[model samples]
Target: MFHYTKLDIFCNDVKKFADADGYVPEAEDICQDFSYPDTQFKGLKNWTQHIQSSVHATRSAQQKLHAWQNRL
Candidate 1:
């Protein structure tokens, strides 16, 4: 059985992979369209939230995929 600690490590790696796989940059591109482009405060905050949620959602999907694969 995979431990929860291992799952965390997997999620972290998934996040890194998501970054390298263009998930983060895509989020940045999307958030770039927001009104506060010049300011780091609101834009940064918005993109940060958006990117984090995106990565988290992708990671969860990957986790479910792996679980399903293992079950099969």
Candidate 2:
């Protein structure tokens, strides 16, 4: 049986892999489109939120995948 400590390590490694595999420069492109001050701030804020959510999803997926790996 895999120990909880090993699972924790696996999760951390998986997060690194997911970040490398799933990262997209376009995901952070909104930071550069500062044409209008008000609108850009709002758009950037939304985009930043999206990036955060995506990263969280990727981390969750990594955790599940790692758990399956351990099961197998």
Candidate 3:
């Protein structure tokens, strides 16, 4: 009999349940041999999101500032 572990279950489930083209590489798979939870990558995701949001916010503020300057 084969010894399929818990991780094998998650990978199979994630792959199966994931939507078409929504394939997410398992973080655990990347860190080692698929041995961590999805939350382990949360900080990286959060950092990227923060940078993107900050850039967007800065651009919007700059646009408003420029418009105000033009009016002055």
Top model number, lDDT:
1
- Tens-place lDDT per residue, model 3, 7-32, is 23223433322223433332222322
Q: Can you list the residue pairs that collide in candidate 3?
A: 28-34
Model 2 regions more than 4 Å off: 1-42
Residue 34 error for model 2, in Å? 17
> Compared with the true structure, what per-residue lDDT tens digits does model 2 show for residues 23-56?
3222444444332234533665665764575456
Candidate 3 yields a Cα-based lDDT of 0.38
In candidate 1, position 36 carries an lDDT of: 34
Give the poorly placed runs of model 1, Cα more than 4 Å off: 1-42
Candidate 1 overall Cα lDDT vs. reference? Answer: 0.48
Clashing pairs in 1: none
Q: What are the lDDT figures for the candidates, one per model?
A: 0.48, 0.43, 0.38
